[model samples]
Target: MGLGTGQGLHYETAERLSAALASRTICSVELVESLLGRARTIDGKLRAFIALDGADALRQAVESDRRRERGAALGPLDGVAVSIKDNMSVRRWPMSCGSRMLDGYVSPYDCHVVERLRAAGAIIFGRTNMDEFAMGSSTENSAFFGTANPWDLGRVPGGSSGGSACAVAAGLAPLALGTDTGGSVRQPAAFCAAVGLKPTYGRVSRYGVTAFASSLDQVGPMGRSVWDVAALLGAIAGLDRRDSTSSPLAVPDYTVALGRERRWKIAVPREVFSDGLDGDVRDGLRRAVDFFAGAGCEILDVSMPAMDISIGAYYITATAEAFSNLSRFDGIRYGHRSKVAGTVGEVYAKSRGEGFGAEVKRRIMLGAFVLSGGYHEAYYGRAQRARVHISNGFGEIFRNCDFIATPTAPTVPFPVGAKTQDPLAMYLSDIYTVSVNLVGLPAISVCCGFSPQGLPMGLQLIAKPFHEEELLAAAAFFERNHDFCRRHPKIDQ
Candidate 1:
């Protein structure tokens, strides 16, 4: 299929498109043009992107075509267009992070991830939308606008990586980048029926990516298929001198893990099927378990009591880190300066008061409270201990099982504004995802089944730290037997 037909080009997986580009059946310029054309025609409804640079993207695409013509293609992703989340620095591109605090701020240099993408010859095109400072569970907290779920316009697409997930789900880009601090990547991928992977915390560098929770923040890949996500992960996963937290271990070829035949030992945590889980989601998880068992993989019911306290511990730890990291956005520095400043104190107070959105402000305050002298030992200290406990709990389970399975979220996508009135209800949405971050393990969300309302539900598979190869292999094996990934939302043109 050609770009002119506007049929298969928009939804083709990055893996397939890469091969097509190498063979000269379709050029990188043509693929970018087709996707850009579709974004112009439909992005208004989904609000997936914050900005798009046609000239720059096409310029890079032309270079990719020239490379292929001269037999100098960089690698498999040389010409594929990858959408970037707004928080990652793209040198000269506005790095909004979905907040007004950095209103007109343009990145002065490329972050580590962007540098890696450039090295791989990938054409970076659009900057996707996100929650303000990556604080909220739904995209509703975004200062500019909320991104709609492509599966159902009235519902949310999950956050703070909702825009990236929506872009992949809506076919705006075959592959995109999303930062997962506390299920931001996997949650949205679940809601939108796309595949999202959260590599082990240090597996991907955080040098150029905007931070939410320093210890938990990780940049991950989102795509329609597991293989596409694997390809993107291979391109960006490696050590970066700029980020001390980045791992020094060698990056593996993730695609090689696909189609591996093995009798895997999988663990199903009993805590994940709690009372809060929606009925439809619970049923879907059971079906997934059955599939694994039928495929000759051994499934065991594992108990990890620490899972019960993950949400509380995560909020305390994540908010405290967020408070510290965001302190640098003062009016005296590079961010927004108060236009009606009378004194230095007033500038700092007024600028922050006017710049940050309500959600961002709430998290900042929560973080400060926990880190305060009076509450430091009571909250932050205890949270640190709890995080260690959770990590140890996962270690014990992994000793007997190769992987752990659970529902990505407790419920399917809720209508926009459904839980906005209750912050506690909204916080519970990440119940199943935060623990993985706290423990710094690799995890993935694949479309397992759909809800009665026709919305999608995700099956989350988590692995030991830096064992992304095994995680992707298990998810790919499951994906090959189902048609869920092949289904696309019907976007009105």
Candidate 2:
């Protein structure tokens, strides 16, 4: 159980692991082996990883260690094992996005984030599971298998980044990368007691990443602590010409913002605290508010009426984009093709029909309907207009407050089958998170407190676009005063 031991190395924060690697207290190979062994021992129950190439990972680790011995270390993240969500491409690795549609599809090149991680000397650990096409709020929609919450095995890990969140929470990886279009990173981090960051849209490039909702999707980082998330973010966030939507802003040293003292103005949206919120979650939010207040931070009540329609607007907009982006997967290219098909049209029809899971098909159909004649203006157009209004609302709020605070999710992690049959309830899981994505702002979820049922809850802090440094600082302040991140789930191996 000692910090110097191999068993303890797997659960250590990336920050500490980096230090260990730098000092040669332990080599990168030892760290990778420990994590691989841990995953081999417990991943059957959690189902966090879709695929793990231990040989490739070790090869990368050995290179990292050699770089350090030769005094050519890449950076602080060098030698760290970072898990990747299945949606992001890694050269020669399967990028299925937890869908049968992309079954056996391997990428020839690394995604933007993966490229950055390699430059920083981080090892690509494995591909974690997720909701098929990143369409579901819970990972139960994954075509392969559902990931379980590490806190309570019976409960579900929030998704479609559940596998990434579960891997970090269960001590399988020190840090992980996840794609958060609508709370994929934060909600699961909340449900699993970890830290997740959804950076400002365009802050990180989206090229080579499988698109779910093109306009909304952003590469995010998940880890056991705010510092860990900050370190990962520092590495992967920057301008990329490959993605037209990528911002040209310079990436800041995110770790520098941590541990800095600041009295920030935090806005609490009154609309987010509704009757739908679980009492335990509400209580946790209240405690978080009190903590900030006690820390001399100014807390104000703000109203965002657009939040009321964020879910609807998000679904319309995201689904429409998903439909357009997914059209390329018609089985003619490199994805899953139907073995039994007569005509080319039948190939397209049967391929999609057989390849896509229920949730993905539902979203695609919904997207098609909204984009269809006579309905585009009625649904998709209005959603676009609503998106503007929502962005304006956040702009107004930011005019007075530095950040917005809310519960990451209305409830703790639900049982695996609890809301699977009720899609509406499942969709509501991202209620507090979608608005940030809609506005293309930066937001983070840190473990605020635990529910009465012993489940973790998150306090989501959102900031203006490209203000990740400030947002991370505020979350780091809270994390420093709380012990939530230090606690780990006891998963029996």
Candidate 3:
């Protein structure tokens, strides 16, 4: 790939590109236009973005260049191109969330993350596709179109942040933001060979993001390298008065983790190695552990018995929250209304039935069931208690070990339709990941190895709550020594 050309610069990380832009080696307009042009040429096959406004992006690029010319550049990220997930509100953009429900609904206000990115002069250029309502493990759940894995187009990219992962993997954009309710960001990043982070639940504000599971959802960054991901995270992370769930904790300079190395007490849970894990993924995790051991870290074996029941608990609690959160999208005020409705009840039923895709509908129905009078105590309440058990279990583990390590997913990217027919199998894809969300801890997925089939595999490192600096530093340590992070998907060929 050539550096000056759009396609060449496509693989450049946000950190490197920002340095180039700051030094005037290349103008922001040129970089933005270059990426936009690359998107125009290759996004057809990848379908990573649902909406792109070249005119607006170019205008912002010009403004960024002018600010830099006047020595008023906001920060290192000023003028760096970034993509936002469709679920996040970006003023005047179509916030479809990969569903027909809100097809033409334009956001009137920017989300907190969007506000931060814009404030730092980062060019918010496109809306990336996602699973409908961020409910699926694969992009195939998208109502519009499924994003293909850049490594092998016929296979799937894990979701609901699949589009963002694909965009970064295919060199369409250097950085993108995705929500991680239950491994949505990390799982897809693993499949796409990119870096994805899921911060502690209240670490990032959720003021304008479309709620999936309000208690669990967190907006995080994705990029080709840990440094790039950390940079993006630093730019968008801080306490926000707009979101009540946002923590009032101070934000740290994430980039300070760069070049820093330390030996960590990393725990390996046996529960993560269930029969469902593919052989290649198991090998990948093993190799990653060996790498860390070689770097002077102690590898400890621990058992998280709560993991066995986490999937059931997660689905129960998450679906219950989803049922409550999605109740606002009835056709009466906003979103798509069904013309076939003849009564108020019909309006609610038909509009939702028509608007939501199968996966979303399934989740909504399951959520409603779980929250129903008789089942609420039996399922939802039980799940909440199970979540407490999982959280406590992690608390005890963290006291002894600095972090927990596991394979990001049970397997690498599978064929597009491989598990869609079996919902239970699809749910298993996130078995190793959902518990972190349950406990509201910070975690990251970094490419560790590849499957025999050539698909990317990731090793996840999870830290204690509000310990993102340590998490990113550990990831950067591995990234600096490992060769996996340097290999880009050969999609152009």
Candidate 4:
């Protein structure tokens, strides 16, 4: 564990060392060997980690140098060193839902945020790529790998947590752990500038993740700021009696909700910037609404006709709950089984047609032809009444603006095989964060500007159900009045 003095760790933000590591002066094997040496020197150019535990991250930085020579009590992400996105799950590794029929499937346990980041001594240090099973947007449908876009590798890092937004946009994991069902960790941390979060829907703890549309999945935190996505969402949020949709509440102190009371009101949504939009994502949401109306708050101007049927109501409730949660990868109990089957429906259709991948067999044959039976009431009961009319149009625009800001994505990272044979033009590139994951509220994206082809451009914020500390203090007040983390994308420096 002698990377012990990796010198003044750059970009690390857990409120500047969670009280300077209580007294460890930066020794968690020097921040997990300087983030496993920038995830092994730029993860072969951003194909963001799918496994590289570096001897279990130097044996958990040598058990936090033996609990700091036996003083013990740590936890506030103790040795903090996050990163986990291979559709989540961490225990004996390989929880591959990026499908090759769960290529080397291994999980047996751990994943209530990997047991709260290994009981807050945090260091999962590996597994990233996503899409298959997590179902695309762009981690380029991950049959196994292909993340890129660490600020323009040929564009597109936005994704099914595009390798956890190119591992915290190529700083290579100062933080990570994404999920978001539709916006897949805030559209790959806004096409990879970084600072995601989706929470709210049962506020973090989907037991062991890996289910795509479980009433629109969650599990937030991606970073580079916004107090390191609210200190990795206050160390993986709470209440998980092993997640019966967790959320029993009382998990505040999200970095004390970012210097509280910068005062807010927000809500812009005139049907999400009507028209094709792409003049730098509409001048970066009109310069984040004129820097939040020159910082005195109050922006109002709502309306929501279910935002014109939220991308055909989120592709008919996420392909009818991804054809019933990918029908538990039928190849016997765990995953990958067919070595020429003798017919148990020919080993569940030839081990998921030879372990899926053709945009995951065309979204599992269009979600088994739209939930079969003569098209289950013309597509999953009309996308569950357009998810209660877009959850009452975000409950009537959070009742006149307590949050709503928009533009998490309209266009900016597309170019890696751009819209690969147009899957409904990449499912209308998640039409502005898929109706806040079909009504389970809470969003967040951040960055807020960029794109003249230099990519990057975010700004989402949202709120409502369980609010994620008022959507991370309204995206940390436009990441502190429009400085926007000093403009990222110059090949993620």
Choose the strongest candidate by lDDT: 1
lDDT of 1 at 130: 92
Give stretches of model 1 more than 4 Å off: 1-8
Clashes of each: 0, 0, 0, 0
Candidate that beats the other on lDDT, 1 or 3, i.e. the better one:
1
Estimate, for each residue in 429-468, the C-alpha lDDT of model 3 and write its tens digit. 8898899999999999999999877899999999998999
- Total clashes for model 3: 0
Q: Write the per-residue lDDT of candidate 2 for residues 74-192, one digit (tens) a residue.
A: 99999999999999999999889899989889899999999999999999999999999888877999998999999999998999899999999999999999999999999999999
Error of 3 at 340 (Å): 1.8
lDDT of 1 by residue, 36-125 (tens): 888998899999999989999999999999999999999999999999999999988888999889988999999888899999999997
Q: Can you give the lDDT of residue 391 in candidate 1?
A: 92
- Cα misplacement distance, residue 32 of candidate 1 (Å): 0.6
- Candidate 4 global CA lDDT score: 0.78
Pairs in steric clash, model 1: none
Distance from true position, residue 228, model 2, in Å?
0.8
RMSD of each: 1.3, 1.2, 1.3, 18.4
